[model samples]
Target: MSTISLTARALLLDMDGTLVNSDAVVERVWRGWAERMGIAPERVFAIMHGRQGYSTMAELLPARPMAENRADNAVLLAQEVADTEGVVPIPGAPAFLTAIERIPHALVTSADTALADARMTAAGLRMPDVRITAESVSASKPDPEGFLKGAAELGVDPADCVVFEDSAAGIAAARAAGMRVVGVGARAASLAPTAFAPTLERVAVTATADGGVRLAVSP
Candidate 1:
């Protein structure tokens, strides 16, 4: 595919599946929960990505009380911290992150603050100074709240921001925020992103003369 170029004043990035690869632990948690709940693992995985644990629980166990869902979500969060078995940064993500360090960037994730912290640490990714976690927004991905909050906190207009995401929910959120999105994985392509890449291996970030950031996304 031809390269896609994007220039923006600020960057918004998703944590899981975008910058970090924690598929093993994420799948393990959901599959275990699915089995215990007498639901299919496929059903759990389908709604698990780019969404808050509580939200996923609510969707999975619709008849359950909010209080019960909250308690179960807490347990999931705790398990995530202790289970980083296959956590690692995506290929070329370290350099890509360094290249944009001087620019206005925020980590916007559906995971809770504590869970995001643990996973990022396990993947050897330095936590960004600005972050929008599950607790940071009343509504989660597919709602546009987190990305909107991230852009606002970075003092950049939504149109001036570029988002990196790997899931349909996150991609939808970025688009809803009026930001151009660079889809980060194979699954992202089906979401109709502005740019799509299977991995960050060939992605390039350059600082433009006008103090803007340029992302050269290669296939």
Candidate 2:
């Protein structure tokens, strides 16, 4: 399937794992948190992807009070933000972003404002003019709140936006928002998207002089 051919006026994107590679840092911090709380790190990691820090902590340590979970998440997230030495833009992220820069694009991340800003700054990617971070929505991914909010912020209907995502939760959000989605990684593709590519580099979007777009996928 071709990504450029999707008829959309705007693009909605997920941050971590989709546009930027921050898995290492995320896993490291979550692992430490799990160890400290006496939970299995691997189990913690499984549910952490595509979720807000507070949400992940709460789910992983349900016995703890919400206040305690929030405090622990804050400490861990701060450490992750402080240690951004290895976080980098995902492969083809620069090119993909450049391709869509001329068009309306909004970041719809599960990350809260602070972590989103920190990750974007670490990757040196240009910040989106419109963004729907964790704080912007009452519900997170798989609920479509973030993507819906992003499309609204861009002044485009949800059906008129294409979402690029790398996790099942993100893909589910996009689908629930009534938008077509292009999965950017293996796991995401398995969830069934409009199309799937190994990376953004394998996908291309071209805008024609007639104000229409063409999406192309390279095998």
Which number leads on TM-score? 1
TM-score of each: 0.96, 0.91
lDDT of each: 0.90, 0.81
- Tens-digit lDDT track for model 1 on 1-219? 799999999999999999999989989987888899999999988888998877888888889998887888889888988899999999888888888889899999998888899988998988889999988998878899999999999999999999999998899899889999999887787888899888988688999887789989986
User: In model 2, where is the ten-residue run with the lowest total lDDT?
Assistant: 210-219
Off by over 4 Å in 2: 1-4, 208-212
Worst 10 residues of 1 by lDDT: 184-193
Q: After superposition, how far is residue 63 of candidate 2 from its true place, in Å?
A: 3.8
Candidate 1 segments whose C-alpha is farther than 4 A from its true place:
none
Query: In candidate 1, residue 41 scores what lDDT?
Result: 97
Candidate 2 lDDT by residue in tens digits, 1-219: 434446677889999988999988988888888888788998887777887777777776678798887787679878887878779998898888888888888999987778888999999888888888877988767788888888888888888888888887788778888999888876676777887788888888888565545667553
What TM-score does prediction 1 earn? 0.96
